[model samples]
Target: MKRSNRLVALTNYFLENPRLHKQLPYFVNRLETTKASVSEDMDIIDAVFRNEGLGYLQRTTGAGGGVKYIPEYLHEKSEAFIHEMCHQLADPVRILPGGYLYMSDLLGNPKTVREIGRVFASAFSQMEIDVVVTVATKGIPLAYSVASFLDVPVVIVRRDPKVTEGSSVSINYVSGSSRKIQTMVLPKRSLEEGANVCIIDDFMKAGGTITGMINLLEEFNAQVKAIGVLAEADDEEEERVVENYTSLIKISNVDLKAKSIEVHPGNFVEIGDRK
Candidate 1:
C-alpha cells in the first residue's frame, strides 16, 4: 500500500484497538512495508496524536515490547466539555419532579456518551483496569464506551437475579438518595478474582448506589480502581458517602418552585492529575 494509505490503516487500527500491543515486524509484514518505513509512519502518527491531544503511542523495543495507543482526552478539552455540559444542565427545562434531572436526552445521544466516555477513559488511563463495571440499564452504554477506549470488558450489576446466569451473589444495601434498602445481584462468573475495576454511572445522589456496588464488588475481591459519574447531586443536606470519585458535572441546586437549576464542573477539575 502507498504510504498515505498505510498511514490511514495504521491510524484506524490503533484507534479501534487501544492498548493492543504488537511487534514492529507485525505491522511491517501486515502493511507490506520495511521496518524503517513503518517506524517513520509511526513517528508521524505519534506526533499528530500528541499535538492533537488525542493520545500517545507507547512503544517499546525489547523482545516483548510493542506500540499501543493510550487515549488521553486532553485535560483542557475535558474541562471545556465539562463547562459546556454544566451550562446546558443548568437550564430550568432539565428540572424534573422531586428535584431530579431530565438527562435522558443527553445520555441517549451517542456522540455525547462517547465524549463522556473519552473523558473518563482519559482520566483513568493510567490505571490498569481489567473491567469497567456499572449497574444495569442507564449506565450500560457509558460503561461500554469507556471499555471501548480502554480495551477492557464490561461487567454489569443488576437489580434482580437472572436465573439464566446461574448462581449469583446478591447483596442488600440502602439507596443513598431514596434511603431505602435495595438488592443488587451479580453472577458468580461475571468477574474474575482480584480484577481491577472501574465503575461508571449516569448519576449520583449521595453515592448510595455506587457505594453499594463497591461493597458488592468486595465479595469477589475486585479492586475499585476508579469511579466516574456523569452528574452528581450536590445537596449539602445530604451527607456524601462516596469519595474518590470523578464527576463530570455537579447539580448544585434544583428548585422545583423556582424552576431553576445550578450546575458546574465536577471535582475532577479541582483535583489535578489524579493518576
Candidate 2:
C-alpha cells in the first residue's frame, strides 16, 4: 500500500488498540512492507502524534521487541478544555440547591465525557492500573471512557448488588456533602485481590464518597494507584478527608442568593500532572 494509505490504516489500528503491543513482524506481514519501511512509518506517526499533542509510540527492542500506543492528552489541550469548562460552569443557571452546581449535562455529553476521559487517562497514563473502578450511576460513563484508553476493564461499585452479580462485598459510610450514612457494594468477582486500581468519580464534596470507596477496596486488599475526579466542590467550611487526587475543575463558590458561581481549573492543571 502507498505510504498515505498505510499511515491512515496504522493510525486507526493504534487508536482502536491503545497500549496493545504488537511485534514488527506482525505489521510487516499485514502491511506487506519491509522492516525498515515499517520502522520509518512508525517514526512518522510518532512524530505527528507528538506534534499534535496526542501521544507517542513506545518501541521496545531485542527478543520481545514491539510497539504500543499511549493516548496522552497534552497539557495545552487539557488546560484549554478545562478553561472552556470553567466558562460553561460559570453561568448562574447551573447553580442547584444546597449550593451545588448542576453538571449532569456536561457529564452526559459523550464528546465532553470522552474529553474528560482523555484528560484523566493522560494524567494517570504512567500508572500500572489493573482495573478502573467507580461507583454506579454518574461515574460509570467516565470510568468506562478512561478504561477504554487504558485498555483495562471497569469494576463498578453499585448502591445495591444484583443477584445476577453473585456474591458481593458491601460497606456503609457517611456521605461527604450530605453527612448521611450510605452503602456501596462491589461483586466478589468484579475485582481480584491485590490488584492495582485507579478510582474515577464524577464529583467530590468533602471526599466522603471517595473515602468510602477506598475503605471498600481495602477488603479486597486492592492498592489504590491513583484517583481522578471530574469536578470537586471547594467548600471551605467542610474539611476534605481525601487528598492526593486529581480534579479537572474546581467549583469554589456557589451563591444562591446572588445567582453567581465561581469555577476554576482543578489540581490537574495546578500541579502539571500531564505532559
Candidate 3:
C-alpha cells in the first residue's frame, strides 16, 4: 500500500490499543514494512498525539523495547466536561424524596460512562491495580468502564449470597445513613491473596458501605490501592467512614423539602495527576 495509507492504518492501530507496549519488530512484521519506515511513521504519529495533548507515544530501546500508547484525558478537557455534568446534576427537578439526585439517566448513557471511565483510568494510571471491585448494583457500569481502560477484571460484592458462586465470606456492617445492620458477601474465589484492588462505587454518604468492603478485603489479605466514586455527599455534621477517595462530583448541599440541590466538581480534578 501507499505510505499515506500505511500511516492511517498505523494511527488506527495505536488508537485501538492503548496503554500496551509492543516491540518495534512486531509492528514491522505486521505492517510488512522495514524498521526504518516504521520508525519514521511513528515519529509523525508521536508528534501529532503530543501536540493534541490526547496522550503520548513512548519508544524504548534494548532487549525488551517497543512503543506504548498511554491514553490520557487532558485535564482542561476533563474539567470542562465535568462542569457540564455538574450543571445537569444540579437541576432542582432531579431532587428525590430522600435528598438523592437522580443520576440513572446519566449512568445509563454509554458515551458518558466511557468518558468517566477514561478519566478514572487516567487518574489511577500510575498505580498497579490487579482488579476493580464494586458493589452489585448501580456501580457496575462505572466499574466495568474503568476495567476496560485498565484492562483488568471486575469483582462485584453482592448483598446476598449466590448458590452458583459456591461458598462466600459474609460480613455485617452498620449502615451510616440508616444506622442499621446490613450484610454483604463476596465469593471466596473472586479475588486472589495479596492482590492490589481499586474499589469503586456509585455514591457515597458517610461511606459505611465502602468501609465494609475494606473490611472484607482484609479477610482476603488483599491491599486497597484506591477508591473512586461517581458522587459523594458532603455533609458537615456527618463524618465519612472512608476518608481517602476520589469522586467525580460532590453534592455539597441538598434540601429535600425545598427542592434544591447544589453540586461541584469532585476531587478528581484537583488530585488526578500523579507526580
Local distance difference test values of all predictions, in order = 0.92, 0.93, 0.88
Per-residue lDDT over 143-186 for candidate 3, one digit per residue giving the tens place of the 0 to 100 score: 99888777789999999999999899999999898899999999
lDDT of 3 at 46: 87
Arranged by lDDT with the best first, the candidates are 2, 1, 3
The per-residue C-alpha lDDT of model 1 at residue 48 equals 99
Model 3 segments beyond 4 Å from truth? 272-275
In terms of lDDT, the poorest run of 10 residues in model 3 is: 266-275
Worst lDDT run of 10 residues, candidate 2, spans 266-275
Q: Write the per-residue lDDT of candidate 1 for residues 1-275, one digit (tens) a residue.
A: 79999999999999989989888989989999998999999999999999999999999987887898899988999998888888877889888888999989889999999999999999999899999999999999999999999999999999999988989999999998787999999999989999999999999999999999999999999999999998899999999999999998888778899898889888888875564
Show how many residue pairs clash in every candidate, following the order shown.
0, 0, 0
Runs in model 1 lying further than 4 Å from the true structure: 273-275
Angstrom error at residue 13, model 2: 0.4
The positional error of residue 184 in candidate 2, measured at the CA in angstroms, is 0.9
Model with the higher TM-score, candidate 1 or 3: 1
